[model samples]
Target: MRIADIYKGNTPVLSLEVFPPKPGYSLKSVFRTLDGLSDLNPSFVSVTYASQGESTDRTVEIASRVRDEYGCESLAHMTCISHSKEEVASVLDNLEDRGVGNILALRGDIPADFSDDKRDYHFASELIAEIAARNNFCVGAAAYPEGHIESKRISLDLDNLKRKVDAGAEFLITQLFFDNRIFYDFMERARYRKIDVPLVPGIMPILNYKQIKRILMMCEVSIPAKLLNMFDKFSHDPGDLAKAGVDYAIKQVSELVEEGVEGIHLYTMNRVPQVREIVFRSGLREKT
Candidate 1:
């Protein structure tokens, strides 16, 4: 099913994002994680893409399993970085053949050693244009509520987003955010710009201090002072920190839902227990 269709109804949609195992990891553990998450009854699950050769195969394999074996709709992610036009087409063809109906188009991070002059695709808008030409997939693109790390200004970011939509993105899912106010402000800007597709807010419950710090730094997401203080006070206690993280996510989600946002996507990080707790506590399970 197209993720955009899932948002057509009045009931709020709840989704999960899971990544394929890295190069040397076993697929067994990832399948196990999917098995555990299936019980939460996500509106759909999105499988992230990997640029590595073997892991790329696993990306489609697991996404097909999510729909075929687990009886859930799947959105397969495809990134254009470090790929030729033919390579991107082949991946899309594979996804269509496997019965996966949705895609999240991305211009993934470029390695420090890679040069842009040698790249076939540089921006996500270019990739979205290629996908649009195929006219066979429901496409989703990423949005940054707090301007993207690489972007100089949020206005520029929204302008780029408009280009993606014009190129044929059906819907959008935002990067993980800690503050609801930021998301609300982003929506206003997006609407004013006339980029009016369903914008689903992405949420990631911070389970550990070290892990979250690393991710926040990489994504260039600002940590709220309140959340920073919580981490400082409970950094020494893993159990307490985990509980606090779940609570914080629940609070964030609850407010988003109350605001009548179109959908919510959880960056599960392959941790079923934390996601399950947030869904149940935030009353998402009841609505979905």
Candidate 2:
């Protein structure tokens, strides 16, 4: 089913994001993660894309498996940064063959050695239009609540987002943000701009000191003082740190649900136990 349709029929749609294992790993571990999270009743599971050759294939395989193995909808992510228009068309055919109907179109990080002459797509808005032209898959795009790291300002990001929606994105899922206030502010600006698709908030649970540091570097998200203090006190204690991270997520999810969020998209990091705890403790499943 189209993810947009799912949103139409369901309230507070619960979703999870899991990536395909890197180049030389088995799918066994990811399946196990799904095994543990099955009972949370996710509206759909999004399989992240990798631009490399075989890794991209695994994205299709894993997304189809979600439906076949678990009887749930799947949202397959497709990155356009490294792909030709021809390559993307082939991917669309493959997705249809596998009965996967929803997609999250993205312009992944541009390669350091990227050459303009060979690029078929420069932005996600172009990719969204391509997928929308096919009219076979439901198209979704990403939003950065605090503005994208590459973007100079949030208003500029919002302008770009409006164009993507105009180009054919049916809905949007945001990058992970620790501060709900940031997301809340973004939502207000989005509505003011008249971009009226379902705006789902993406939440990433901070699991360890290393992970937190890496997220800061990669996403450029601002860390709230409460979280900074939590990390300061618990970074040395893995067990306590995990507990605190999960607790923080529970609070975030609970408050967003109370505020009538259209959905909660959890970046699972392929860790089921943490995600399961967050969903239950936050009362997401209970409300469903």
Candidate 3:
């Protein structure tokens, strides 16, 4: 199923996002992880492309396996860093032949070893345009609720999003955020700017203290003071922290659904147990 179509109908939909194994990791482990999570029967699963300087072929192979072996819809992440136009064309052809029909187009981060001039596509909008000219595939682009790291302001980020939509993005999935208000504000702003594509909210259920810090440092998102307090109180206590983290995520998801958001994408991090717990407590399965 095209995820956009899933959102258009009455069935409440949920999807999973998984990263391909890093280069040199055994494919056996990746398959084991997939087997653990497959019974959830997500609306779809997205396999992230490892960028330049990371394992590349394994990512593609995992995406193909998710669709063919698992019998689930899959979206392959396509990174434009360190890839020439010709290289991108070749990858697209390979994807077509493999029966993969969905992609998340991104202008990935520059490699530590490569100079700026070595990169072909600097902006994701450019990649969106190129993919729009191609054959049958659902093209997705990223949205930032707070703002992108590269953009100076939210207004500028919205303008960048408009360019991608104009280039024919089918739908949008936002960067993971904790606060529901931030995502609601982003949706209102997107409507104000006349960008009408179905916008899916990315939900990350915080599983631990270290992961929270990593998110604050790496992603352009803010942790609300309430959530910060949760971390501050339980950051040192492993058992208590896990309980509080799941509760917080459940509340966040319930409120978002009450507000009529399009859908939710869980960043599973290849951990089936944690993802299953979140879905069970969130009351989403019963409500739908």
Q: Note the residue pairs that clash in candidate 3.
A: none
Task: Kindly list the per-residue Cα lDDT of model 3 for residues 149-207, writing each as its tens digit.
Answer: 87899999999998888887878999989888889999999999999998889888788
Supply candidate 1's per-residue lDDT for 260.
Answer: 91
Alpha-carbon RMSD to native, per candidate: 1.5, 1.4, 2.0
Residue 215 of candidate 3: its Cα lDDT?
76
Residue 174 of model 3 has an lDDT of 92
Cα lDDT listed for each candidate: 0.89, 0.91, 0.81
Candidate that would win on lDDT? 2
Higher-ranked by lDDT: 1 or 2: 2
Q: What TM-score should be assigned to candidate 2?
A: 0.97
Q: After superposing candidate 1, which stretches have Cα over 4 Å from the reference?
A: 51-54
- State residue 174's C-alpha deviation in candidate 2, in Å: 0.5
| Model 1 per-residue lDDT tens digits across residues 117-235 | 87899899999998888878899899999998999999999999999999989899999999999999999999999999999999999898889989998898888999989988899
